[model samples]
Target chain A: MFEAYLTLMVFGVVSVGFAVASLIGAWLLRPRVPDPIKATTYECGVEAVGSTEIKTNFRFYVVALLFVIFDVEALFVIPWAVSAKTMDIGFVVGEMMVFLAVLFAGLMYAWKKGALVWD
Target chain B: MSETNRENVKNSGEDSQGSAQAPVPGVAKPSIPAAAHAKPAAAAARPAAKPAAPAEVLPEPRLNNGRGRLLGSARLWPTEVWPNPWARPSFVRGAYWLAGIVAGVLLLGWSVGEISVWANLAYDWAMNLLRLRQVPELWAQGAWSAVKVVVVFHLVALAPLFLVWWERKISAHMQSRLGPMYVGGFHGWAQTIADGIKLMLKEDVSPRAADAWIHLLAPIVAAAPAVLAFAPVYFGSGLTAADIDIGVLYIFAVSGMTVIGIVMAGWGSGNKFSLLGGLRAGAQLVSYELPRTFSVIPVILLVGSLNLTAINDFQSGYWLGFIPRWFIFYPVMGQIAFVIFLIASVAETNRIPFDIPEAESELVAGFHTEYSGMKFSLFFFAEYAYVFLSSALVATFFLGGGNAPLPFLRIWPSWLWFFAKTGLIAFCFLWFRWTFPRFRVDRLMDFNWKFLLPWSFANIAFGAVYLFL
Candidate 1:
C-alpha cells in the first residue's frame, strides 16, 4: 500500500515536473514581446475590442433547470430499482408502472409547456 | 535592447522557417530520423539559446489539423500568449522556480508512493512462494497486478500523444491527404514530443485583468486530476489500483472535479471568451453528471456491490460454454444501462458532438483562451487522458473488466485481454472525436436530459422489475 502511495507520488511529481519544465523551458527560450494588438484574444481575423460580457440567452438556463430536476429525480429512483424484482411481483410491478406514469406525466407536462425546446 | 531585438528577429525567423518545410503530409510511410539531425543542427546554429526572440520571427507550428472543415477552422482552438497582465517582469523567474518545486514535489511524491506499494507486494509474494503451494494461475495475479500499474498508468500516460497523432492520421486519411510522415521514425511520432519541447520553451502569461492565482492554478487543476483519476483503472489483465471499494464512484467523483478546474481556468483568465467557455463546460459537466452517474447505478444494482473488482468477478465466467456472462447481457434494463452509460460517459468527458464548453465557434476556444505554454498543454493532454480513462471505465462497468473476449481464450491470461478491450474502446473514443461535429450547447443539454436521463430511469424501472422476477 505504501509502495502504491510512493509510486503515485513519484508519478505525480514526474508528470508535474514535465508540465512545469515545459512551461518554464518555453518561457526561457521564447521571446516576450507583448503589444496591444498581440495580447488581444484572437477571434478569427477580427481584433478583440472590449470585455466579452454580453448577456447570455435565457434558453440555456431553462433547459438546464429542467435537466437538473429530472436528472436528480432519477438518482432517487436507483435504490428502489435494484431491489424491485425479488419483492411481490404484482405490487412491485404496479408500483413502478405508476411511478413511471407519474414521471412521464410531469415530462409530458414539461413537453407541452415547451420548456425543453431550444429555439 | 536594440541588439537583443535584432538577435531575436534574426534567430526567431530562422526557426519558424524550419518546421513548415517538413510537416508529414498524408499517406505517410514510417519516418526516418530527420528531426534527430535537425535538433542538433538547429541547436548548434543557435548555441547561445538567445532569450526571447522577436514574436514575428519565432517558429510557431502552423498545424494543418487535416484538410477537413473542422481542421480548417480549428486553429480557433486556443493559442496561448505571454507577457501576461498578472506578471511583474522582475519576479517572473522566481515565480516559475517556486511554483515548479511545489507542484513537482507533490506529484512526484504521490506517484512514487503508488509504485512502492507494488514493489513491496511482489517481495512478500516471492518470499511466501515456497511455503504456499500455489497454483500458477492464482500466483499470476500478483505479476498481473504489477504490470497493471505500469501499463495502465504509463500506457495511458503516453497514449494521448499517439492518439493525437492518430487523430491527425485519421483526419488526413479521411480528407485524402498525408499525415505526419516525418520526425521520430516513419510517422510524425516525434511531432508531439517536439511540440512538447516547443511549448516548454514558450512563455505562460497571466492576462492583465485575470486573477493571478487561479490563472496559474487552472491548468494544473484541470490536468492533475486527469492523471490522478488513473488510480482506479487497471490496464492489465487482472490488475487495478488495489481494488478500491468505491472504484467506480472514485472515478466519477474525480472526473467530475475536472469541471471545477476548467471553470477556474476560464473564470480566472478573466477573458470573456474564457469565462463563457468555462461556463459552458461547467454547465455541461454538471448537467450530464447526473445521467452519467445514473447510467452506472443499474450495473451497481445488478452486481450488488460498488467494488469494481467484485463486479468483475461476477462477470468473469461464461454461463454455458457458449454464453458470455458480462453484465451488459442482462435483461432489458441491463441493455439500457449499457447504452445510457456509453452516451453519458462520452458527454461527461466533454468529447466531440458534445464539446460545447470549449466550442470553437461561438465561444472562440472558450476557456483557457489566455493560457499559453505548458499550461495549455495540460488541458489538451488531460482531455485525451480522461477519454482513455472513461472508456476503460465503461469497459469495466459493463463488459467484463478483465475477461478475455473469447470464452476459450481465458487460458491466455487476463491482463492482456483487459488492455486489449480498453484499448479498443479508447480507439473508438478518438474515432468519435474525429468523426463527429460538436453539438450545440442547447442541443447538447437537451439530449442529456430528455434522452439519457429518461432512458436511465426507464432502465431503472426495468431493473427493479427484473430484480423481482
Candidate 2:
C-alpha cells in the first residue's frame, strides 16, 4: 500500500513540475508588449464598471450546503459499498437500506422546502 | 484608436451576419421580412462598413440532414458532410458506420492473431535488458515509476493538441463545413501544433485590477490536478502508473481540486462575469459530483473492491457463453448507473448541454475572460485533459478497463481494448457537444439535484437487492 503511494507522490511532483515548466517555457518565448488598455478588465470593449465583489444569488450557497451534507454521506457509503459483498448479505443490505432511508427523507425534506427550486 | 475602431467594425459585421444567415427557408418565415429589412438598415446605420451586396448575393448552402424531413434544416446530423451510401435518407448513416466498424474490428482480430503474445514478450524482453534483479529493489521500482510518470506527463501535455483539433473537425463536420483542411497538408493533422506555436509567440496579458499572484498560479493549479489524477488509471495489464487500492477515490479527490483553481481564476480576474462563472462552476460541479460518486457505488458494491484492476479482473469471462460479464451487463441497475455516471461526467467536464459555466454568449468566455496567450491555453488544455480523464474512468468503471468484449477479440492486446473503449466514449462527448442545446443554469442545478441524484440513490438500493437475491 505504501509502495503504491510512493509512486503516486512521484507522479504528483511530475504533474506540477510539467505545468511550471510549460509556464517557464512560455515566459521565455512570449513577447512582452504591455499596454494600459490591455491591462483593464474585459467588459465587451467598454470601460469596466463596478466591483466584482458584490453579492451573488443565495441559491449557490444553498447548493453548496446540500453538497456538503451528501458528500459526508458518501464518505460512510463508500467503505460499506466496498465491503458489502463480503459481509453477511442480508444484514449489510438492511443496514444500508435504513441509512439510505434517512438520507432519502432528508433529500425529500430539502425538496419540499423548495431548496431545489432554481427560479 | 485604430484597434478599437476595427473591433467596432468586426462586432457590427457579426451582428449583421446573424440576420444574413437567418433566412434558411423553413423554420421561421416571419424572420424573412425582418432579415430582408435588416440588411439595408445595417448598411444605412453604418456607411463606413463594407458593402453588404456581396454577402447578400452569396447563397448559403442548404444542408440535407438525413431521413427526417423536419431535421433537414436543423443541421443536427452530419448527413451532407460524409460520403453516405444512401443519398436520400441519410439519417441511418450512423447505424451503417457502427456496423462497418464492428465488422472491421472482427476482421482485424481474425487476421492479427494474438496481439497480447507479442506485447507481453516485448515487455519482458525490455525488463530483462534492464537487469532489475541485479539492482537494489527500491531503485528498480523507482526506475519503473519514473517511466510511468514520463509517459503520463507527456500524454497529459500532448493529448489536448489532438483533442482540440478533433473537436474542431467534429463540430465542423456536424455543421457541414470543412474545418482546417489546408494546415499541414492532408486534413490539417498538425493544425494544433501550429496553434501551440502561435499561442506561445503571443503576448501574455493580465488585467491591472487582477490579483497578480492568484492570476499567475490559477492555470498551474488547474492543470496539475488532472495530470496527477492519471496515476492510478489502468491503461492495460501492468500498464497502470500506480495500482492503488482506492484508485477510484484517489481520482475523485485529486480532480476535485480543479474547482479551487477555477474559483481563484474567477475571483482574481476582478471581473463580474469571471466571478459569476466561477460561482456557477463551483455550484454546478459540487451538485453533480454527488451523483457521479453515488453512481459508481453499485459497481464497488458488486465487485467488493475499490481497486480498478480487481474490478477489471472480475469483469472477465462470459455470463451466458457469449455475453461478457461487464458491470454494464448487470440488468437495469447497471444501465441506470452507467447513464447517471455518463451525464455527471459530462457535467463535470463542463461540456454542453451543461456548459453554462463558460457560456460564451452569456459570460464572454467565463472564468478565463481575463486570461490570454499561453495562460489561456493552459486552461484550454485542462478542459480537454478532463475530457480524456472522464472517458477513461467511464471505460474503467463500466466497460471493464482493458477487458475484451468478446472471446475471440481477447487475442488483441488489453491496452488496445482500453484505448478503443476510451476513444468511443470520448467521441460521444464530442457528439453531444454539437447535437444538444445548452442547459439553462437553473435547470442544470435542478436536473442534478432532482432527477439524477434521486435515481442514482434508488439505483444503489436496487443494486443491493439484486446482489442479495
Candidate 3:
C-alpha cells in the first residue's frame, strides 16, 4: 500500500513531465515570429470587431441539451451490447429488440418534436 | 558550419515540398509527402523508384508533424535532454508506436503463461471459499506478502507508461504515420525513456503568485488515487493487497481524489484560466461520479458482493458449452450495468468528450496551466492513471473483473484472465482517448447529470426488481 502511494507519485511526475517535454520540444521546433498585431486575441479573420470579451452564443445550450440526450442513450445501450455478445443469442436478441424499441420510441419523440433536427 | 551547409541544401531541396505545408487550417494530413496522404491515385502513380537518389536535404523538424509533441510549444524540456533528437527529423514517432505494439505483445504473451499459474491459484482460493475451508495461513500470505506489494505497485505504474505510448501510437496510426519509430529499432519504445530523462532534468518552475504549499501538494494529491485504486484489482488472480469487503467502494472513493488534486492545482495557480479549468474538472468529475457509481450498482446487486477476487471467481467457468465466466456474458441486469458503467466510467475519468476541464483550446492547458517541470508531469500521470484506474474497475465488475472473455480459454486461472481483461479495457480507454475530440463543457456536464444519472437510476430500479423477483 505504501509502495502504491510512491507509484502514484511517480506517475504524477512522469505524465506532467511528458506533457512539459512535448511542449518544450514544440517550442524549440516552432519558429518564433510574434508581432504586436498577432499578439492580441483573435476574432476570426475580422480585426478585433470589439474587445475579446463578448459572450459566446446562447445556442450552446441547445447543443448541450442534445448531447445529454445522446449520451444517456449510449450509456443504456453499451452494456447491453457488451453483455449481449457473451449471453445466449436468443436472450440477448430479445432484450436488444426491447431496448432498441424503447430507444427508438424516445428518438422518434425527439424527432417529432424537432429536437433531433439540427439547423 | 556543417549544420548551416546542411540547412542550405535542405532548404533548397524543400522547394517542391513547400507546397506540402499549404495551410488547411484545422486539418491534419500525413507527412508521407513522397507518397500522398492516403491517396489511391498516388498509390498507383508510383513510378519505378529513381535508382539514384537526389542528394537533397530536408529539415528534420518538418518530418515529425502532429506527433505527441506538445502543440504551440517551445522545447523547454526535450531540448535539455536530446538537443539533437528534438531538433532534427527522426522516425521517433513511428518508433514509439512500434515499441508500444511490441510491449503490448510482450505483456500479452507473458500473461498467457502467467495466467495459467494464476488460474491454479484462483481455483485453490475459490474452492477454499466455496467449501468454507480456511487455509488461514495461505490467505494471510496472499494479502500481506512484501513481494506482492512491490510487484503490484510496479504493475500499476508500468501500465500507464505503456498506456501513454499506446495512446500516441494509436493516435498516430489512426491519423496515419509511424509514431516514435526513430527512438528504437522496431519503434520508439525507448522514446518513453528519453522522455523520462528529459522530465527528470526539467527545472520545476512555480508561478510567482502560486501558493507554494498547495501548488506542490496538488500534484501528489491528484496522483495518489490512481495508484491506490489498483490495490483491490487482481494482478494475476489470488493477488491483491487487501481483498476488503468494500473493494468496489474503494475504487469509487479512491478514484475521486484526482478531482481534489486538480482543484488544488487550479486554485493554487492564482489564474482564472486555471481556476475555470479546475471548476470545470471538479463539476465534470462530480457529475459523472454518481452516474458512474450507479451504473455499476446493478452489477453489484446481481453479483451480491464487492470482493473483486470473488467476483472474478464467479466468472471463471462455463455455464453451458460456450458460456464464459465474465458478467457481461448472458447477464440479466449485468448487461445494462455494463453499458452504463462503461460510458459513465469514461466520463468519470474525464477522458475525451468529458475532458472539457482540460480543454487545451479554450483553457490554455486547463488546471495545470501554470504548472511546469515534474509538477506538471505529476498531473499528466494522474490523468492517465485515472484512465487506467477506472478501466480496471470496469474490468472487475460488469465485465467479470479478470475473467477470460471466452469460456474455452478458461484453461488459465481467473487471476490471469482478470489482468488480461483489465489490460485490454485499459487499451480501449487509450484507444477512445486518441480517437475522440474534447466535448463542449456544458454538453459534457448536462450529459452526465441529465442522461446518465437518470438511466443509471432506472438500471438500479430494474436490477432491484430483477433480484427481488
Candidate 4:
C-alpha cells in the first residue's frame, strides 16, 4: 500500500519538477523587454476601465453550493456501488433507493425553485 | 514621402477632432503620424497636451484600389498554368492511394508479431547482461521501476506535442485547408516541435496588476493534473505504471484538480474576461463531471471491480462465437452508457460545441488571457493531453483496452489495438471540434443538466435491471 502511494508521490514530484525546469529554461532564453503599455491588462486593446474585484452573480454561489452537496453524495454512492454486488441485494438496493430518492427530491426542489434556470 | 506626410497630417487632424468628441484612448492614439517629429515647433507648442500619444506613432498608408489589385495579382497564379504535383492525371492519384492502403495493411500485419518479438529479445538481452554482474535483487527491482516511471512520464509529456499537431492537421483537412504544411517535411510532422521552440524563446509577459505568484503557479497546477492522470492508464496487458486497485477512482480524483488550476488562472490574471472564463470553466467542469462519473458506474457495476485491468479482463472474450464481449456490446444499457460517457468526455476536455471557457470570440483566449510564452503553452499542452487521456480511457473502458476486435484475428499486439482505438477516438475529437460550432453558455449548461445528467442516471438504473435479469 505504501509503495503504491510512493509511486504516486514520485510521479507527482517528477512532473512538477519538469514544469518548473521548462519554465526556468524558457526564462533563460526569452527576451526581458518590458514596457508600461505592454504590461497593462488587455481589454481588447482599450485601457482597462475599472477594478476586477467586483462581486459575481449569485447564481455562481448557488452552483457552488449545489456542487458541494452533489460531490458529497457521490462519495456516498461510489462505495455502495463498488460493494453492492457482494451484499444482500434486497437490503442494499432498498437502502440505495432511499438515498437516491432523497437526492432526487432535492434536485426536483431546486428545479421547481428556478435555481437551475440559467437566466 | 512628402505627399503621404501631408495626407497623414490631414488624417491625424481629423482623428484628433473625432477624439475630442469621444476621447477614447486606444482609438485616439493610433491616428497620430510619425511626421510630428519633422515639425518640432508643433510638438513643442502642444507639449502640455497628452504626452503619451506620439511616442511610438507611425504613418500607415491606406492602399488605393489599383495598388491593391497590382499587389494581389502579383501573388495570384492560374491553377491550370502552374505545373503542380496535384495537377497530375487521375490515375496517378488513384495509384498513390492504392499504394498507401496496401502499405498500411502490410505494416499492421508486421506490427502484430515482429514488434513484440524484438521487444522481448531486447529485454532478455538486458537480463542476460545483468546476470553477468553481481546486482542485488532489491536494487534490480528498484532500478526497473524507476525506468518505468521515467518512460511513462515521457509518454505523458510528449504525446501532447504530437497530438496537437495531429489535431491541427485533422481540423485543417476537415475544413478543406492545409495546416502547417512547410514546418518539418512530410505533412508538417515537426510543426509542434518548431512551435515548442518558438514558445520557449517568446517573451514571458504578465499584467502589472496581476497576482504574480498565482499567475506563475497556475500553469504548473493545470499541467500537473494531466500528468498525474496518466498513472493508472494501462498501455497494454501487464504494462501499467501503477495498477492500483482503485485505478479508475484515482484517475477521476486527480483530473478534478485541473479545475482548481483554471480557477487560479482566472483569479490571478486581474482581467474581467479571464475571471469570467475561469468561472465558466469551473461551472462547466463541475456540471459535466457528474454525468461523466455516473456514466462510468454502469461499466463498474457490470464488471464488479474498480480496477481498470480487471474491467478489461472481464470484457476480453466474445458473447457469441463472432461478436466480441466488450462492454459496448452489452445491449441497450452499454450503448447508452458509452454514448453518454463519450459526450461527457468531450465536454470535460473542453472541445468545440462545449468550449465555452475559451470561446475566443467572446472572452479573448479565456482564463489564460494574460499568460504568454511557456505559461500559455503549458495550458495548451494540458488541454491536448487531457484529450488524449480521455480518448484513451474511452477506448479502455468501452472498446476493450488492447484487445482485438475478433477472437480469431489476433495478429497484432494488444498495445497496437489500444493505440489504434485511441487514434480513432482522438480523430473523432478533432472531427467534432472542426464540424460543430461552440455552444452558448446557457445552452451548454442546459444540455448537461437536462439531457446528459438524466440519461446517465437512467443508464445506471437500466444496468441494474439488466444485471438482475
Best by TM-score: 4
TM-score of each: 0.68, 0.81, 0.61, 0.82
**lDDT tens digits, residue span B1-469, model 4:** 1222334445566443332233333434334455544554334124224334322233343445436432234323222253765666644775787699767865775555544455457657766666678676555545555656788899888889889898888888777666776676666889999999999999999998799999999999999889888888878776677778898889989998999999999989999999999999999988888888888888887777788888888878877677888889888888998898889889988879798999999999899999999999999988999999998999999999988899876766677778788989988988898888888998888888778876776777777765566
Residue lDDT tens for model 3, B38-103: 444324223343233233333334324635343224443234345655454444874676699777
Which docking category, incorrect, acceptable, medium or high, applies to candidate 1?
incorrect
Pick out the ten consecutive residues of candidate 1 chain B with the lowest summed lDDT: B23-32
Scored against the true structure, residue A3 in model 1 reaches a CA lDDT of: 41
Question: Which tens-of-lDDT digit does each residue in B200-313 have in candidate 2?
Answer: 788889998899999999999998998999898888777777889999899999998898899899988999889999889989988999999999999999888889888888
Please state the error at residue B129 of candidate 2 in Å: 6.6
Q: Candidates sorted by TM-score, descending order?
A: 4, 2, 1, 3
Tell how far residue B382 is off in model 2, in angstroms.
Answer: 1.2
Using TM-score as the yardstick, the better of models 2 and 3 is: 2
Interface RMSD of each: 5.0, 1.0, 10.6, 1.5
- Highest-scoring model, DockQ: 2
* CA deviation > 4 Å runs, candidate 1: A1-31, A34-36, A44-47, A53-115, B1-121, B125-153
RMSD of 2: 10.1
**Cα error, candidate 1, residue B274 (Å):** 2.3
Candidate 3 structure quality by residue, lDDT tens digits, A9-95: 444444445444445564454445545554332223444333312343343344445545644665555455335434565565556
What is residue A71's positional error in candidate 2, in angstroms?
0.5
DockQ of 1: 0.19
Writing each residue's lDDT as its tens digit, candidate 1 over B112-131 gives 43343565687567646733
